[model samples]
Target: MATESARSERAGGVSSLRGLAGGGVFLPGDEEYDRARTTWALAVDLRPAAVAFPTSAAEVAAVVRAAASAGLRVAPVGTGHNAHPLGDLTDSVLLRMSGMSRIDIDPDARRARVEAGALWLPVIEAAAAHGLSALHGSSPDTGVVGYSLGGGVGWYGRALGLAANSVTAVELVTADGSLTRVDAEHEPELFWAVRGGGGANFGVVTTIEFTLYPIETAYAGMLVWDLRDAHRVLSRWARWAADAPDAVTTSYRHLQYPPIPEIPEPFRGRQLVIVDGAVLADDAEAERILAPLRDLGPELDTFGRVPAATLARLHMDPEQPTPGGGQSALLDELPPAAVDRLVEVAGADSGSSLFLAAELRQLGGALGRSQPGAGAVARLDGQFQLITGGMMVGEFAKQTVADCERVVDAMAPYSRGRQYLNFQEEAVDPSTGYDASTWDALLRLRKNADPAGLFQANHEIPHR
Candidate 1:
């Protein structure tokens, strides 16, 4: 429950927001408040004093002003994919941008101007019509703004680099309620920060323009094997991935599919090991590269040529909202011995409490090369990434967190002592994702742009 003084302040804020155009505001007890505050991860419950659904930059500015007038801070969210780190919002106003989804494709220029609320699904479909694709994550439902702003790693990252490198411009509504257009040539400092410094640290992004690739289709799909073959398969995968070309990006996972009506018949209630990825090459070339794995003769093989849009579903990620928790680490290497250790702990025979997935993604190639004028998080320095996650429900949720920590601890010797911001499930030191100089630069930029500390609840960058 809010104190009397806090409630009074929120009531004043709601009054100011009611007069705004191009958007709707919901108060704490309003019928739409709960639905408006709902995020992609159901485990995060945000109880803000008010929620604003802004349809345009002007409307977003109005909401920010309303929050200021009521003596509260503002927290802008797209699909709220990383909401767990946002500790508390009782005195904050959530600027929900889901109502402003829009995408404009300039095929001739090989660029797409995407709205803050838009997901990668529409952008992928639209770009495919022009034989083009964006550097998008595995899940198509993830918000474009948040992903790119946090150094997005996707199926094409090995070849094209992090998604933040592809961003060209951003239209943002800053702290003082001023809408500004920033890029390399305009507000270069702010542009650099917004690219991979995390979007919320600056302001609410209204639109972003990014470079796209000319790719209509790619050789991509998944290969599954029974849990009994985990040791051999995972060890072989590690060796193969070490020498794989830049054109190929791959990940191997140990999955436990629950016996639920929503799950597919083949994967339902089954424990399996799977390898899936994308190859930016012709079918013949892809087969030549994948022949070694094919020789393993897995029980299920679905690898083949597929539309670029289909890459979104290749990882079998949940398409709808689901309650889950996850932890990630960047690894210096994944040798055969390390692979064996992973299998010993999370394999089907291990009786692991984690109920969903544990994965290792091969990373190198273009992702390790620094480009001129790249984002704050220019490139990843590690060779592999380890991710462990499970559904958050009942006692299993507690066990899942502990099991994930144990996995990380077991693999500590191979870890690079670094983490990716987008994959982080809990609040951590901002410096964990960047080097000393980069962290200092980010803090200085944060102090300059958000002096009043408007956006401080979500992955905040501390002021110097």
Candidate 2:
């Protein structure tokens, strides 16, 4: 039963959203309001004042103005893949960008420009049509604007650096409901801040552009072993990742699959360890670089050349909305002691109830070097970014969170206490995602651009 005051508030949200040029708006009590507020991370139940689907940059600006007029803040979202931290939106308008998906590729120039709502799969396929590829993350359906803005680490991360540095330009709606474009030459400060600093900290991005590589295909795949080999396999991967050339980037993971009919035979209800990635080289060269790990004897090897576009789905990340939760940390180094601790906590005998125990990305190489005129977050100052994830549903949701945090806490000694905001599903101090100097500069810029705090972000950088 809705209270009289609550009904009035919902009515106000609807009335203020009138005259939207494209798409529509939904307020509480509306038939579609519940569906509109659902995020990719299904566990997060967002109860915003209202939800708006804006189609164009102009429409986005109008939504912002409407929210302001209605005495509410505006929060922009693409796929809501990392929506866990956006705790309270009761006083805000949830701006869903799904209606604005548009992708454009210039094959000759090896560049791509996409609307804020676009997913990486479409962009990658479009780019691949011209015999090129973009720096996309593991999940093909991830929103390009959000991932690139928050610093994307993918199969080719070590070689190409972050997806943020590759971003060429951004078009957004600012606090005052103005559609503005920023690049290296205009609004350079905001441009720099949004690249790796997370766009919502400033405003709602309408479109974005980034570099595409001249790549058709390469030797890329995974090497799988049973969970019992986690200790030995991960140990080798850590050492290999530390000294391996930048031409190749990889991750070591411990995966536990549920024993269900939907799962395939090989991985169904099985506990396993896998090392997967891409090698930007010919078959022989890639094989040679992977020889050390191959010698260790993997039960299954799926390394070979394939179409560049296929790389988007290499990691087998979910393509649909799923109930999940996770935690992550940037580690300085993973010495033998750290490795032992990780295996002890999440290994086969640990009795941990989690889907993915550890997904440690190999950092350094180009990712460690700061580029000239790069964004606020130039490089990740750590050797590895450790991630832990699990399904958050039913009676196990609380246990899942505790399990993920336990792994992070166990490896705390080796961590630099920093974070890769892209992989972070829960909220933490946004400053931990950037350097001390970078955080300070970002705050100053936020203070100038949005003094009234009219915009809300998942990992908000507090200006006040």
Candidate 3:
């Protein structure tokens, strides 16, 4: 993809895209260029030919129309959370919906109508006001539409279906530059495809309406352990997670916290074991169920009643920007043997600072329950998803892909031959991400919806 400056040069040396509605178009030299193009990953750098910050769906439609008429491409972005810096769009028109932030909660119907730019925090806060909750991302800072497009899996995924499953309707700008509303009752096929097809394949999503659940506060937090016991902690978590009840969801992560004053003293500058536990129910029930795991010798136990507003901080994920790499796979089962094998590869003994964090999130339960028109969701029936990610550096920097594969091979005995789209690192063969049946269906849908292959730059899917 060409940069905005390069694209504009080709377009008669014009800086702003003409005929765009409402707001002024941002060109190459604009002061907002840098801030507008940055994403959460710090890896993705997008220099669009122009950025149209549409305040209304009509303005968005205008930008799409102009781009289509000028033979330019449009890639929608939401706070750039899912973006990878290397995924450049030099000649494209980046349609940023960040200015379109709006949240409308219909408590009576237990639903929320969200604009494409609304982050999970707003939705959670809005729903909390009505004693309702949505299947939002573990990190509330993540974009709602982007997460859903990648098949939203959250802390409560075991009890409720994916965030994608909660979608009731969407307003999209299709390939031909038409703004259309899609639902189970309207344009059902497209609706099915967009449920989890990944974004920008079919069109630009402007607004989305999704179902909400009644959950104000629950028992959720992490139990941290010293790196010395990483092996024991990892092994124990594996078995305990396998038999965990539906209401109890947890993920095991081995992380190296930077030596920063903001970081707690116990966790700062050390390889620590953290078990993220969430119970979307009353405190007593959660405490009883989590007691066994809690007794497993944690250095610091932060598990207790906490406000939902502070949920994002519990994970303590990196807030700073840096280039990184990651990979993930679904497991059919994690028996005692499988747990032992995983401990060998990713445990404390696994001599790889390259492995910043490896997480094992328990899957299945409500996630396995099929919903109408679900498309390309990752590991619905799997028992767990094994994921690893870290900053790309030194020899390890160039070997992210190989390391990811190495992790996968080490755990192959328990893997179910399924992959999670979000956790996929660059250089991963696309066909491996989806099962054969899913790959075939995705190809057929791609041929039907985007025969021109305009969105191929963002992802790889064989289109005849």
Candidate 4:
């Protein structure tokens, strides 16, 4: 392996990286370097020593070997949605895998083989054509491999469980430049580690195979009410969520829309409380399940039988790149008192400075139960998930960091003292995302898989 001096010498140029087979190498001064290094989260500005786009798993291995020879680490990025947590990348090689986006759906087997670079949108569309659906997150644009490896929680999560749990196999390039396939029957430990321990920790994943559900349509949509009813809506949601069946997955958001043309006319420059979710049942069953909330008389109700492909847009997440700050936490429960506390801090009358969207996602059902021989993060022990974020624009950008912390601080009492790895915006202890046993097992497995410490990027598991 190359030494520190060798790495420093190679940092000035990308000639060695360019010599690699089956990939594109980009240096700081390269024409595409800036665009290649840009991420979905506009807040992240990365300046890596080099950026490489590998077309195949063999090419990925070649890049890994090259980086090892240059005494540099590799940070594999897909769609770059979680780039903010990666911190500095000066000494690393950013591996851009968006070029290998290929999805093969096996409707007979009820599974989809997704390449690392594939996004959820294409996969969802492909599955929908076969009247099937994968456990995909809210945003269709999010990368599949990254989201699945980090324990994806989607609109159908309550019914089908996490996306990570659905993964049946993974193909990756190990630290020694060897391409390996892992699954329950092969490399079982590594399979467990990658499922929810966070990808890019033990190796660079090239593709993943996950199971899909047989469903063409379901009852899904959003219900909106003026901010005046924030407390009442939230309280009802909390109570409903507690006893909600496995068929329903829901969340409530307190939104403060900016006075911008991008926002809808009625919602722009206003504070609104919205309840959004999906029920994996027919219209009649869904209506029965959602009858209580419907009886509350929302100002706007859009619930109806919708195609599974359309579920991704229910949250109304920005389809284009966005600049924002985000923070999240897993909560033990959202009791009445906790609901009051949240409304007091993030409600319309709260005069809050940083939060543009504050939400509490219902957690339970399949998410609360661990499957036999599950992955690293077997189950989420919490009852609800709290997420708060703000658009980072102009003055708000500077205050976002502090404001995020302030919200987290205020909600500390109800926190489970844990966080979801995918939603974390900063580097946090891996222990926070797992139990003691799982954390320890992950550390041991990471060390064994990447003994040279070649792959250490965002939310990395320390070798020691």
User: 2 or 4: which has the higher lDDT?
Assistant: 2
Error of 1 at 201 (Å): 0.5
lDDT by residue for model 1 over 41-115, one digit each (tens)? 888888987788888888888888778877777888888888888888878888888988999999999999989
Runs in model 3 with CA error above 4 Å? 1-24, 29-31, 85-88, 319-322, 373-381, 393-396, 399-405, 431-433, 460-464
TM-score versus the correct structure, for each prediction: 0.96, 0.97, 0.89, 0.96
Q: Encode model 4's per-residue lDDT on 193-299: one tens digit a residue.
A: 99998779999999999999998898999999998899999888889999999999998998888788989996888889999999998788999999999888998
Cα lDDT of candidate 3 equals 0.73
Q: Which portions of model 4 show Cα errors greater than 4 Å? A: 1-7, 10-14, 21-23
On lDDT, the candidate that comes out on top is 2
Candidate 2 TM-score over all chains jointly:
0.97
Q: What TM-score should be assigned to candidate 4?
A: 0.96
Regions more than 4 Å wrong, model 2: 1-14, 19-23
Ranking by lDDT: 2, 4, 1, 3
By summed lDDT, which 10 consecutive residues of candidate 2 come out lowest? 6-15
lDDT of 3 by residue, 1-464 (tens): 55776555556533436546565577678887777666666755567777778888888777776776665667787766556522556657777788888999999999999999998888888888888888876776777888887678887788887878788898987766678898989987777777777656777889999998877776998898876687777677777777778997788887767788987788778887788867987888898888888888777777788766666556665555557767778888877777676666666677655546778887877777776567566346578888877766566665555655667788888876766666565545656666678777777886776675544224456446
Residue 137 in candidate 4 has what lDDT?
90
Q: State residue 284's C-alpha deviation in candidate 1, in Å.
A: 2.3
